[model samples]
Target: FLNKGFNVVDSSVATGKIEVSNAYKIADLTDAGAISVGKQLGAEVIVKGKALAKEGPRNTGSKVGSYIADITASALRVDNGAVLGSARGHGVSRNISEVTGGTEALEKAAREASGKIIDQIIAKWSGEVSGGGLIQLTVRGIGEYSDFVKFKDIIQGQIRGVQAIYQRSLEGGIAVLDVEMKGNAQQLSDEIARKNFGGIPVKVIGASANTVEVSLGGAVSAKTMSTPPSSPPAAQPSPPVPAAQETSSFFEADEYLVFSGDRDENGRVGKMVTRPTATNPEGEFLMYHDGQKVWSKFFKAVRSAAASELQLGSRIYFFEGNHKEGVYYSPKDKSEARLESWWRDPVTDNSLVNNRGIVTVGRYRVDVSNAFVEKK
Candidate 1:
């Protein structure tokens, strides 16, 4: 959920700590137990979930068994023991193996439930903000006590709709503030991103529905980087871009390949296609020959590509382009691929376009000379 802008606690770390403490059974944990565990893990919210799976049907001739799974999840605010929201999902799968089918069904259900629960939480937070509620601000890079005091003053005096600020804790240049504001954390973050506090550079690093994380460019020499006090100019802040996180996408065996051609000297003959998988949301190049995947490599896109790029039809195709160094296709044979889309990078504020004829898996090059362009 980092892409959604919340600082998520690692699940493995919390699980390991809970396992060692002999805490309440995860499946049957109470609200009190959840709050205790959340406090121990320094988490503001705790998400609890359960899954149930059952075999539905069996086709003996085809050796395909059907399984159904149901998943339910809820988010709890640890401080108040309040239920933010809950969601449920169902999934069905058919597989030759019973265990595999059940597992797949459960995974699908979990993904659906997780997404809905996250959406609910964000909606709830937005409502709370509109009603004038509390928001948490994590400020870092404070050079001294004076710097933090000045920062707090700026928030209270300059920012609109700020009711009050309560200092939760401050240690090692990091301070957590409980802010009572009429506006949401995202709005506050965006406003802060555009300001320069007395020539102290500020950046909004992370922001969510209820929380914002900011860093000040202060440590060694703040005055050295400061401009004249009389000539202060406002700068348009670059929007934040969410970094890549780990995710997995399920693909069936009958997945289609987009473009293929004759084998090169390395015996790598196949169609090259792009897929935006969970692991590589940017995109990856997959090569397949005779309906079998030969190799796959990640592709650097101008921006995040759409998951629709992996459609199981002839929507993907090779286009004619001039052959260049580090590219696999040439115009002479008319076997090149180009992405004819453009997107603006929020962080860099730059227009990016992806038009490539390159196809390589590590040190090996794949031939695409005889490939023909086809689109559905």
Candidate 2:
């Protein structure tokens, strides 16, 4: 009797190799049940089959009967519900030999059926990968649906260069986010690092020119290599403040910060500075009417809030009202500029929504909205 069962077995030959599992009865391939088994089997693609064996018409009244088998199967991508293509196989007994030739016919039919389906799977995968620069990015440590939601939010908000996020899959407690980013892998990883995700610590563990792996709740190591620190920057004199420049006691500890548009001295158009102790900025305001020398006078307490972000050094930094853009810190010495914000903005409002702007940095933030008083 012909073995009328669906066999998904991998075969090996001197010329080729494939890793397939034992055949399965189509009735047991329930949608949910098949997915679970497929995951355990590490199946890259799934194949479904249907076939039939019948007596060949040529089996005219001869004592030996001829048999033919026709088989077909469909291939599908595991992660996405993408249908690759359908493949079919046909087989006929070479010569009626034993009590029945259907067994041989079925065997031939099964081999051809599997070969065609596997080919369809390979072609579909090749098209997906080599066509539109689609990359397979996997982010691990995503245990639940809510985590996926947050991860999606962070990716869309923090990554600006991504053209699209085509698919997201949760498997083996790992979440895979497939996206097409504009630059190579390293560039994409760096861009993702610049933005704050608020909760989980994200690290780019593996990256190639295309494929990338993002790990959640992981710490990124600091780069050890460095250029010899340039001989200490040459000593430069501080900019000259107007004789009538206001001074404030708040800056007694050198807590003062200065900001100017361009290199200093005299007629620079956007020149501005903050004198933390300045009680009144009227004199400096009239000097450069475009509101230079903002000082600490403009800051009025809108609200007092604490930070709940993971990257912020301390839970302090009162969050000034939400200003998407942070003011530039123009120090006389062009060392790496760092902003130490004292107030923190509660992220429950989704403050870190985009990649281009700074949500929070350092340990201090001034009331930016209130910090600027237009020269009314």
Candidate 3:
């Protein structure tokens, strides 16, 4: 597995004195038991299976030993206990010695099964990264609602290939956001450490395949980590503008974010930086036109009316809208995706539809027809 580029956990690590409630019986472990063991080993995916060797057809001429082995394996994502991929393989070997033949057959079967499992896992990873999959982001140490707001804006402003950010919940100073990005959690976590989010210090506490844990204001000490208040504070309203400033505020135009195209040697899209300076790192699937950044995936702000009606942990869908307006349509792909809520955009006339289970992230189409809540 290490030779195959996977970070494998040593078998010896689980050999003795391991902390699990299953009586340390590997053969009788259930899926939940396997997940607990994986968590102890700090593994993102755990591959576990059984192998069986049985008698095979004898040779015609010579009296030779024959054995056939069957191997089955599965790769599972530890965080959500999702079975990413699985495979089975069989091998046959003939030798004068029965034990040697059985051993060779078992080894061959294990090799074949591992190869198939690896291939399937890699294919699934590629499809998710390119198809705008959702990466679960957990931000801790966010005591202020404004900080939560700023964090969302920071993700929107800095990250590349991010179509939408769904606010899942805020509890105990931890905010859960489901971000749809054209990359994996590791890539997003790396980017979070590099950029500055309005002077807020952010740190990547932990990261898995599709989940990232972030800490605001750097690391939190055990003494400082306390229970949140019984009720969350309401978002503070913006201070009222003076009479003189109110008159001048109308002249300030809405400044849509803009960027310039950055491409690499193969013409693959690079990072879209605002200034394109040496300090700025390039992102993926981003292009700029008229100094305004146009992303391959973008989401409009959900109207206030729509957000108020949304219930926590309920899925929604969008089915109608004009190609023009805030919506961007692509001729090549016309799939309807769940557009994340943007905090900065103006409220429009878009409505909300009460539907679930139909979601397909398009490379270029923006679903402006409706707004809906996501179930955890």
Better of 1 and 3 by lDDT: 3
| Model 3 agreement with the true structure over 234-305: per-residue lDDT tens digits | 322222231221111111111111222221000111123222226534322222110112342222111212
TM-score of 2: 0.36
lDDT of 1 by residue, 1-376 (tens): 5677888998686776654346675454555677687877878888876677889977667788899997656677765444565566789999988899999999899888888778867876766755666667888777755556667788887998876775656656676777767877777898788766997778888876567888866652232322222421122122233243311121122222222222211121223334445775432232221112233432222111232232222122221122233232422321212211111111111111123322332221222331222212
Q: Indicate which candidate wins on lDDT.
A: 3
Error of 1 at 189 (Å): 19
Ranking by lDDT: 3, 1, 2
Q: What is the TM-score of each candidate against the true structure?
A: 0.36, 0.36, 0.45
Ranking of predictions according to TM-score: 3, 1, 2
Clashes of each: 3, 18, 2
Model 1 misses residue 78 by how many Å? 2.3
